[model samples]
Target chain A: MNRLFVFCEGPDDIRFFEGVLKSELREGYASVELIAYAGMKHIRVDGFIRGIGAMGDDYLMVADIDSDRTVKAKKNRLKRWYRELDTDKVIIVIKEIEGWYLAGLNDHASRSLGLRPLPGTDRITKERFNRMIPDHYVSRIDLMIEIIKRYSIKVAREKNRSFRFFYWKCLE
Target chain B: MRIKQVSCRNFKSFSDLTVDLDEYNILIGTNAAGKTNFIRIFRFFRDIARHGLGNAISLQGGAEYIRNIRISSDVPTEIGIIFENELGVFSGVRDTRGGSHTLSFHQIEYRFSLQIEEGGYRILEDFLRISCSCTPDLGEGESGQGELRITHTEDGVFYELSTPEGIAIEITEIIPPYLQKNVPRSGTLLIENPLLVPMPGFQRFFAEIAIYDFDPRTPRKAIPLSGRSDLEEDGSNLAIVLKGILADPEKKRRLSNLMTELLPFVQDIDVRKFMDSSIYFTVTERYGDEHPLPSSVISDGTVNVINLICALYFDEKPFIVIEEPEKNVHPYLIARVVSMFGDAARNKQILITTHNPGVVRHADIEDILLISRDSAGYSIITKPARREEVRTFLKNEVGIEELYIQNLLGL
Candidate 1:
């Protein structure tokens, strides 16, 4: 039941992005659900946070600066709620930004520059990453995928490692 | 066969409004409160979205006539309808927003933008979205916005629309292997058909869609001899339909039986055309002498019944829309007519708009709607009469006739 959901501002956004991503990702990823609502003015982080119950799995959500309201406040509020509710279950991305800046980070291009250095994850190659980053047509989905993969691995590693094993080995 | 919701903006008497719906919508408001206008707007948007910009716009007299006579262009002329498809469940929601959002339920979302330009109305944009989902957590799947994914079958294409953006990559391509060879014809979603929005291959994609207005003035004509059968908006081709029915005696017998059950007076339909200018039909009675009933001489009630039957029995469309079904029909038959619609709608989506209390009362309360007007000049559609304060008046103080009179008088 672990499904991925992508929310866009308009129907065209949903259509265009899905078309582009479906070609890049494998068949399983093609089933990712995209929802589009027009003239939507709210950035309620809880809408996505509350959405996790139905997913029963991890989620990667992307929202853009469609409203004139405080992007930072909205982003921070959502991040706080998501971390409070399910720390590793949600990933929020905001685009159409003046510059790419993931919340809680000060460096501009370190992650946002659309670089993929990891091996075996050619799925998010640097070329495709750079290709999707510049224009307003669609945000860098490759990078979005990368961020999701990284968090997914981190969550898995933390979950699988046991501290008692190290203590038991030292005592023996 | 119910209108579940309606929203209107910059339309006749509405500036901006949204109303939820029920099985039978009893649109009540003071005189000139915009009930019929609200109803017509639903069909108008549907016509434009299902058909195309040209057809949708043409129905309101003309482009010039479609412009809001009372409001400015600053407010877009808009309307939306939410109703049950063939199933007892709600199926889709449509609006004039130039965008559509499909839900996980067996529903579709359509939107169009209408604006006044150079003293005429023009569609700025149009979109049609349908919903699909699998068993476990289909809600997320159904909320997709994308091009409809189609499975071309022997009968027709089986369409599954992802979110308007298109299908995602994560979900396994679950279609049968036999259906994999067909390549999607690109730009198919942008074509305009007279009956539906510009979805590629409309006939192949949505041949199951039908519309019946129950109008007696100009009934729908049937396809000619040995022609493919289709339900016309007006019930004109009753003879052609009869001919088609007669050609297949098995189906003809079933039609005869259904007719007998519904209308005991009807024996069998006589198919004929006169003067090459008009097609006419007569009813053969079981006991008395047979008589010709000129298409013109036939009562509106009979014409409406024939039209409803053509839509219910003959047509194979998956979606059927009925407007003002109570018009010209006897109140006692409304329940039977609704039951027939329900039976026919088993495999298709059925949408209806009406204001008759007899019709409303016979329907399950969940199917009833109370359409009212708000101060902001919007039409507010709601369900479960008990939810609204105005419902009390209908439940206690006034009769349906008074409600109808008050609604027309804009009291």
Candidate 2:
């Protein structure tokens, strides 16, 4: 069976992708497996791509924009490490995965989580996400789990530009 | 005999877990992920066989410590083991015609469940089943299928053996006289009278399963001369075991060579006996004018390494479990220590739990079991090599230590 191996940066990014792609990817692929590389700097991009290609399995590399100014610049940065890296297979999250998480919430879901409804989340950072978390949640992972349940891919694509691009490129 | 598989339900942190074990197993997990609890299962069985079920439960700090906290009192704590008998101890059975037949079973499975009662726990169910192939000992050996099952339910303990002709017969009379009277209500019947069991190999196998949670300080103390040759769980009897090893010229030379190889400064390792007849292991160093350093003066890591060597090489146990082999050892020597475990695993099944990335770096991906906790706080075990994604990363020459550090391999 053809398997989809999605490599994300960290646990938060994995949680987001698992919430979004878990059911959606199963239609075309037998199973979807997620690998959290923890950080972008740790990945051996060239070897990872080559190895996955050798296995004849589809993979998506998810990364946060971080300090990179544009998605094109981010792709170029990754290409410097691996020239043969398929830039089209790379999905760049605007700011961070936390932003994509917040982008999924509508007004009711946002209010339920004790946060304001966020119309756009392209500029959201981890620090901003932490500060916005309500005092009721036990920990960051706790809130992430609750947010994933109410997450809406439709709302996420509409509220975040990078997520919209990811929807068009990978999902749709 | 080697344990092929283990299953536990409502036992400590494992609500329900079943894992197939290889010859060598390296368990990696964070604190409170139930690695220690998993290791305790072997010791629990060993204590039950050597001691009694009540004593085994008491040794683990009573019934509260045995059952999972999440589970209710009514739910029974179950443990099952499947063993591959290597010695073929029970290889023959007498037929109905008074003829001997060569009987061989591929595997023996034993399972028991205990329910937590008011004062303590009682055996809810005990089951043992062996499926065997029988070949006539006479001319023209033709194989026939048969099965033997022993179960202890509320009604009473019963033994049922099916002949090669597929005729079922009650063989409860075969149970020893001592076992019939001692049909334990609060203890396991199999453990209470292991010798009386149809297949007696499992009792010896269970009794010899050694678990070492070495205390480096205990080995540093002087141990009185005793007949105990086997290394103790806490390594309290290291000096005695070492004395036995050193008595053999060949084994002594090998021990000296291994110690020197692991600890470069070590010249030789020898036993020192005092006037009181108590003995301690001394390490003679090559550096700074050779002088023998008593175990008390030796570093904790060095003592731990010595204890590990004795536990892995000198011990006669068929299965061994060591907790945190990298406890105090230097990072540079972790690979060598892990390799020693691999070498020892060739003959006997070895399982070691470690948090060190160096151990993971040197270990085969197939031998490593990742233990993680679910959201509900139940322990889960998974093999990284079984995952296609982990295999891909490994194929790319990406070190497992990196994957472990990155929490990429299912933390």
Which candidate's lDDT is highest?
Answer: 2
In the predicted model 2, the residue pairs found to clash are none
Docking class of 1: incorrect
RMSD of 1: 25.2
Superposition error at B145 for model 1 (Å): 11
Alpha-carbon runs more than 4 Å astray in model 2: A1-172, B90-92, B165-186
DockQ of each: 0.01, 0.01
Error of 2 at A10 (Å): 32
Candidate 2 TM-score restricted to chain A: 0.92
Residue A156: error of model 2 in Å? 69
**True interface contacts reproduced by each model, as a fraction?**
0.00, 0.00
Q: Write the per-residue lDDT of candidate 1 for residues B1-411, one digit (tens) a residue.
A: 334455666666556667764322334444455656665665565564476556656676666565455676565665544433422122233323323233343444544456766656544434444444322233433443333343332333344534444434221233334443443232222223322322223333333345566557664343344433565666555667666777786566556655643565776677776555555566655565666455556667776777676676667655566777767877556655655654455434556766665555444445445556656655555453454544565455344344444552132
Candidate 2 structure quality by residue, lDDT tens digits, B259-343: 6546757888888888867889888888847788888888888889889888877687889999888889986566557767865
TM-scores for all candidates: the values are 0.48, 0.67
